[model samples]
Target: MRHTWLICGLAICLSWGTSVRAEVTITPDVVYGHKSGLAMTMDVFTPTENVNGAGVLFMVSGGWYSRWQPPEQMQDRFKPLTDKGFTVFAVRHGSSPKFSIPEAVSDVRRSVRFIRKNSDRFQIDPQRLGVYGYSAGGHLSLMLGTASDDGDPAAKDPVDRVSNRVAAVVAFVAPTDLRIMVKDAPDRLDAYARFPALDLDLKAAEADSPLVHVTPDDPPTLLIAGDKDDLVPIEHSRNIQAAFEQADVTSRLIEVAGAGHGFRGEDARRSTASMVEWFQSQLAP
Candidate 1:
């Protein structure tokens, strides 16, 4: 599977004093939460100038596998958002095989809550946080957007006392219904079926499924899917979009005609632009 770093072509300009520059500073390994003695971390990207103070989280997972890349690589991967003055957090969760999808979901939720609690430290508006990603990463984004909750006032952890809700979501070819995946899992010959992430049974799949929890208050979501995608069909996005509509939530699904699970070239560029535009509109004051 292609990691979603095919977006270097996106041109994002940052206004500086008297001149424009696009330099970004990365704060790496910022621990948001801990899981079973392991640190759940995110690398923060801040534009050198013209900071917008709106934060966007980039879900960095493929097949529920979250690993660390050098900070310099993130500067390339997240430059578009950073250059446009959005502070970007590349969030990594507890990976699969060792951990289940439910665990991954919990990790991301904790990450969001931690980030929200410390929003002032990062100079971001807690109300304007957006999340985006592709594949399993996209699935995680949907989970965040749809199943958000207000803080648990009685929770022991301060992070759990802050809401994990987000303002916007842009998920690329994400698997929306894990129940459907679970049903199809027996017949799947793909690499995804081999992964322990999709090892969930019916009950567990439904619990982690984003489509199951969508409500009117969920974030405005923009789902970009490939019509030719058989791995996670475009129907996944279509079905979720219909649910969003029924709930009177703002949502849109863009089906790229000839594209598959992963977009390329023009498709990639346009998809990214659409993501940026969605965030700009939804995160606006």
Candidate 2:
């Protein structure tokens, strides 16, 4: 199923070859943040046409791990946004087994600040920023929506002084509660074990959980999950959706039937289409 999705994604990319090259300008390897001498970078994709003045930060992460994916590899996932003239920032953070989840979270926050601080240069409206990701990246996107902060006036760094808040969030197959997710999926326990701090500190893990921090001020969120998922249960999305409703925040959860941890074929296409429409509704100018 995953292989079929990859083939379809590749076909979509190939179909868009001429337009992608002519309508999008990709600036790769732009340093966004740094931690412990390691630089976190993002590939910025600006549409050369239409110019909507909106930005969507794409967290390039899975299982709390991150790496730089070439723009071509991401063309299918981000092309819908670019076609509508939204600039896409493929943000990469430090990986786990070396850097913990807390560190990775910090990196994502910093990336938000960095993007907002330089919004003018990127030709995007800082206030219209949105974020989306799948799996671990989805968790991070929720964190940004619920735990964002206004820039400190006294901060020495100008970037740190800018707000990290986003206008909207879209999460796919994400675990809203880390403790419950890890407890429920014993077979996938090794992924969380890579973060030594999380293994030793229960409170820290809870603090990082998105559902624990959601408030009324959180941006409108759209959560997509598979009803048959055995890895991260569908209950995770339902719980978060209920929490958002209690807080008076707009939230929607779409459970794809017969799908597992990953969506493929029709499910995959529907998921991507829903994400694009959600962002357009929330962030389009």
After superposition, which runs of candidate 1 have C-alpha atoms over 4 Å from their true positions?
Answer: 1-22, 183-191
**lDDT at residue 263 of model 1 (Cα atoms):** 85
- Model 1 clashing residue pairs (backbone): none
lDDT of 1 at 222: 97
By TM-score, how accurate is candidate 2? 0.89
Instruction: Report the lDDT tens digits of candidate 1 across residue range 34-143.
Output: 76887777777878787888999988887788877766655766767776789888888887779989988898888889889998888899999999988888999999
lDDT (0 to 1) per candidate: 0.82, 0.81
Best by TM-score: 1
Predict model 2's lDDT versus the native. Answer: 0.81
Strongest candidate by lDDT: 1
Clashes of each: 0, 0
lDDT of 2 by residue, 56-155 (tens): 9988877776765566777767888898888999888877657777887888999999999998889899999999988878888999999989989899
Q: What is residue 268's positional error in candidate 2, in angstroms?
A: 0.7
